[model samples]
Target: MSNAINVKRAAVASLMDQLRADVTEKKLTPQEELAILEKLKVYGRTVAGSDAIYSSEGIIFLAEVASRPDNPDSSREALRCLANALYLDRQTVQYFIDAGYVEKASEAYKSENVDDEFLLGRILFFSTTFSKDDKLLDKWVNEHHLVENNIAAIARHATAYATAASTASSQAVSMMQTMALQDTLKLLYTLTTKLPDVSTTLGPTIPHLLSLLSSIPLQSSPLQPPTHHVLDALSNIPPTTPDSQASYFPTSDPTLHVSKILKILDKAAIPATSATSSRSTTADDFDSRAASLLKLLIEIYPPSPDVVKQLIRDTLLPSEKERSLPLGSQNSATLPARLLRLASSPTTTNTRIILQTLLFVISDEDPVKFVKNVGYGHASGYLMMRGIPIPSEALEEIAAESGEEGGSGKRINPITGQYLDDELKAMEASNVKGLEGMTDEEKEQEAEKLFVLFERLNRTGVINVENPVRTAMQEGRFEEIKSDNEDSDDDDNEAGKGKGKAKA
Candidate 1:
């Protein structure tokens, strides 16, 4: 078995060497280059099954080729071989880290030129994915301008991708252009989401992203996926206060911050109210992207209750309530209603969490207020669609089994009961007093808020609203978001304050 593995590894090594030689000597023509890459990519999978492959010299050889200057096509192929080899293998990730692949790849990425956009993007993408600890990431985030560099690379590649894709008459070139755009956007998404305080990193790219987002025609197949990621990346960029403190459940401004974002959002939202609405992936993708774009827009500007309410109401109630079209038929739901329904779930697909966070914060957990203020019928419809508990008559109806009428039996939810008990216990331990001097109606009104209602209801089933900080952390939000102020005390402690006097 060991000898067989060694032979296979040798075969892979020889293949890598030949590819490198071809690139170095400029021996391979474009057609030959592509053909060889296809062979390497296919061969990579066959040999990837061997544990010995990762430790062999071939792996490093590929990394060097990938990082080599002025060979974008070959570089991409080299990177793709490694990616295919490493896909879903923990051993591959660990071996890459231990063998210093991350550092080497980072160096290559740092030295890469504009033409090496796809190659550079993959380097940053894979390196970050394989980084076992914060040592490298800290260096990039703190001292090195990785965020700045990444945005530049993305913008450069995107402009090229857009241009090539638009003008290229050849199907192959167009396909390559599509792949390039998708990869670039995905890389940007990975960078911003993984890096802390990333919104600040995207200042230069936002205008370009806004322009791209605005240009995407509704349900346009060629553009949606890449455009989708651009919006996804934007939403994932955390909102920040002037002091760099993370905004927890940030608000949306009435104007949606920039006029461009607002306009793009309007364009994207067009599909939600189209004549054909079946909630398919294309539709869902557009809806989700639109929701995420709205989230980023809202978080940038302080949210207005009126604006949110109007947004929901517009979705809930169409311009003509008594239309001739069949109910819930083609494009029955307006943009806000479609997005509201989508946002009710804390699913990652649609930036629903961001929208949910904004709404929950602004609504303050009152379902009744959300209905009365936002669009009672529409809001209720959205909640019911999600099966989220509302803690009112609407709640009973939502929780009740469909088609079962007449009995007034309360829904028995053991999980919800346990959660409420946990909340009560927490409140008692904190010695907080509430509902003592309140009437039932006042208490009901208080319970009706969207914020309170979400706490009681688990739309995503992954969140415990009473412990939002922990929930947020589990969802990969930065711990810094948990704090309103930077840990100046910790810095002071590090600098020696109360424990010992500082030397002048």
Candidate 2:
């Protein structure tokens, strides 16, 4: 009896497995598929243990099953399954759309009670896959109405889909279809006005979309309505506030949104001359725009040396006159200084420009005086080591001026020997004044001692020089003379003795 019960349980499990496979393959007849779908929906809601079965393949199967009859009710069920499947695997939904499953997907998207997840998935699928199908997009747009919630949904959809499609061929197509300059501008305006939170929530996505639109090359014609619209939209975004919007800067990736904007500007063909303007405008307008964009960039992104160097080279270098203008002028040095501070920062990639600028400022004036008086003495040591050439003409002029002065008529000492009589007297007086605090008795005693020492030296006619070795050498010379005299007497005595002996 136990073996029979086990067999019955195994048979029921096998039947359920077969039924699931049938649903996945869409092999059921329309009526049968509908009934199974209803059961699956119930299972999806209550089969507390079978949630893991809703794979991408399962959703594709269900979407296929619903499309079999092309009826509204079936389409709704198919969309729900597809939505659940997408929640599981977005790539799978994209795959289905690529395989020409878009029409069926759109049918399901039209459900009145569609969840945000389902709506978002369908919008992405449609924007990415059927980007060129403006009629379909228009139909959805018209039916959805231009309400904030709908627009927000569309914005979110555009942003999310664009992020995913960034690398796909669909990016170009999607930009061409849904993201014209005008539409992007309008969308951005609406987004910024209604959803200020977008700066934080869709931080990376908004710039990417803007970059794609910006990249489209503009024609030579006067500012078109669409061009103006895009410009206006860009202008509307508040200049990036450092505290709240710091994360919007381009990342380290080479394929960043800012790069895309640069490429777009490169492709654009601005008019050579405008009718309303008398001045011949080159690419300065674009450069100004680029600079403005970079201003926000510097505020949001940590300053990088490369970014700073590029700003100097690209923005400040070209407009030297503007950069050098007086402080209050339209083109003043303030902006350039701010940019240089950012680019020439110690942490930046290129610090040579900063060093060079400092050197130039130092060298422009009388550098010696500047170094001596301006607390730049440390810099002087560096300058000397760096072998900066002192101007030969300046050296010659200094020599010539010095030559005009008369030389001193008398010179005695190479070391402290040139004092005049009055100078020596003044030095003695100062030394005497230094002892003024001594008692009168001490002063008289010092004077009397000096007088006695000089008198004794005069009487002896001796200075009593302190060198003992020299005194000993002089005494020894005198002793040698006296001994020679004694030796002469002894020689005489010896000679007399020799004569006497000869007489005898």
- Judging by TM-score against the true structure, name the best candidate: 1
Q: Give per-residue CA lDDT, model 1, range 1-504, as digits (tens).
A: 777767766665665566768756978776676666667677667654334345546566666666665657777777777776666454565565566666555545544344355555555566666676777776765555566666665665556544544665333234544555565677677776666656566545665565455444334442267666777776776445342222222244433324444445544543333334445554555554566666665565443345544554343332223122222233445444444545543333555555544454445556643442234333554455565555443322122233544212333122221122334555567885445545544433343342333543454552323433223335544222122233455333222211211111
lDDT of each: 0.50, 0.38
Candidate 1 to native Cα RMSD, angstroms: 19.2
Error of 1 at 112 (Å): 7.3
Give per-residue CA lDDT, model 2, range 394-496, as digits (tens). Answer: 2111211223323233211111122233334455667744234455445434433443443454355433222222233344421111112222454343322
Model 2, poorest ten-residue lDDT window? 495-504
Q: Where in model 2 is the C-alpha error above 4 Å?
A: 1-181, 194-198, 201-204, 210-313, 316-504
Task: Quote the lDDT for 110 in model 1.
Answer: 48
Off by over 4 Å in 1: 1-10, 13-38, 46-53, 68-76, 88-90, 110-115, 141-145, 157-178, 202-204, 215-223, 238-279, 283-291, 297-333, 337-369, 373-504
Error of 1 at 312 (Å): 8.5
